[model samples]
Target: MDLHEPVTPFAVLDADKVATNVARLRGRLAGTGVPLRLHVKTAKSVEVALMAFDGTPGPIAVSTLAEAEAFAAAGFTDIVYAVGIAPDKLTRVADLRERGVDLVVLLDSVAQASAAAKAAVPALIEIDSDGHRAGLAPDDPAVLEIAGILPEVRGVLTHAGRSYYAYTPEEKHRVAADEVAHAVRVAERLRAAGYAAPVVSIGSTPSGHTPVELTGVTEARIGNFVFLDLVMAGLGVCAVEDLALSVVATVIGHQRDKGWILTDGGWMATSQDRSTAQQKIDQGYGLVTDLDGVPYPDLLMSAASQEHGVLSVRPGSAAELPDLPVGARVRILPNHACATAAQHDRYHVIGTGSRTVRAVWPRVRGW
Candidate 1:
């Protein structure tokens, strides 16, 4: 059976769109000369990771040790666990590094640095460029403190989470440039204090697609761009058509009076992340589209239950939509690709212009 008909609630990852998205970003960074590290935390699929690096061992950023191990088993050699290093995971981190995976741990505090130093694990200082999350300030004295304390220091890095909050192209560019400058400043501070050339890195999906001067950056780590979601689209980082990940579901019933279409794809299938609410447009749970991927006019997954989704027409756009009978198939574009993909086990890939499932990439979760 085709991917559209095989199941009522399954993830349909557009293989063609994913490849295109990565290639497009790669092309954008071709002139920069700085390497781009695909953050695997979003997809958590080794196959998608392979596509990011052209099927070879290369630089990647993972959120969990399990993801690092998963990619390491699939032939990925370089992995940076982006989250702060837990005092206990140093052993496993070192074990992965010892096994030929260039695992770089993250340290944000002197305590964390001391612990990693004691365990003989190399780490990067998570720079706080956006002020939205944890990290050492760009010029904070702790930069030198951490560097001096860690036995093996990898470099400096930042996520640029503020980029996601940008409301315009100009705002996005400003945030990206600031993040690059912060990483550069931190790297310079480390160097002045006698540390060798540090690996400077900064990234986010919003910044990845926006115009930014990435002069002093050594690497770019972006993940969500692989599967553009409604939030990304709302922020102008990508168009709705660029969304590669979608949930394919079948209509089971409807609330005729209220113009609601019910589907089996609910909170269990599509994650209930309301990220798009912060943007110009808010897709309830997700945006609804036809079986062929065309968006249904004024439609959204207005609400959801454990195993059910209520699709309804948005206000002020009351044009007659196509019939959605029981068992009729539809696709759902997610608001947050990272959260949505987490609910699925394997991606039923559909290549460009191809009807059959091209590949099934298993997703890794836990720890």
Candidate 2:
């Protein structure tokens, strides 16, 4: 069926673009002395992750155990549940281990570590690369103390989430260096303890694009580079031309009085994530664009309610062009690829036409 015919808003992942992104990242990480452990959290789909790996054995990282189990069953053996695992998840972790999958969990505290140790699987220490959220300081004895736990420690991993907060290329590059530094320091601590510490992973799409001095990192798990978004564009990670995925929305109304083009795509289709973390600039929802992925460069969606998105131009430009008629098809570049992908059940595989040639469903919401 023609993907655009459906009134329902859907996401599309271009097969050709996916392949291109994989190649681009592979070339960037060449000789970095670390394997790319593609984080599935951002991609979410087993199909998308498989495409990202492009016929390579991966130490796949997931945000949920359900994603881990789904990918594991699909023959992905080396999996790391990047999010913290609670006591209740131990049973699922044990089950995955029984299947011969090298399942790893994340822990930040001694109590969490002690709890995870009971699951009989090694746990990777999560380092707060930018201190945006949960993770222990790399030099904190707590990391070493957690690693010292026999058989339960699996070394360390970190996400330069702060890169998401960076407003300039220089700032993003700085955060990338800091990400590598955090990993190096923690890895050094691990060596001092006489542990092999095989997994010193670090990444963030924006930070990964810049030159990362991976001195002691053994793995880099990055996602979102697979589907560049407006936020990435704003941070100067990649230009809008590099964006591989977008939401196809049909213009259902035109408010010339207010200079708005109402599309079927709304907060439900795009997601509620503002992604604007008190930064110098905030992409309210996303950039307005043509069906072919051309950002109206001048147009932006400034406000949105559950099922409605309002479009606008900067104060002075609104009067230049006034109308986007009803029934017109358009695409929206999301601010956050991961959250945007989660709102839909499947990606309508777009190839040479407007029709959906196939459906790629991403694993959603669970352990």
Taken over the whole model, the C-alpha lDDT of each candidate is 0.87, 0.77
What is the overall TM-score of model 1 with all chains considered together? 0.97
Q: Write the per-residue lDDT of candidate 1 for residues 162-188, one digit (tens) a residue.
A: 887898777888898889898998888
Write down the RMSD of all candidates, one decimal each: 1.2, 2.3
- Worst 10-residue lDDT window, candidate 1: 313-322
**What is the Cα-based lDDT of residue 154 in candidate 1?**
79
Residues 219-290, model 2: lDDT tens digits? 888888888777777787777677777788877787787777787788988898777434445667877777
Q: Provide TM-scores for the models.
A: 0.97, 0.91
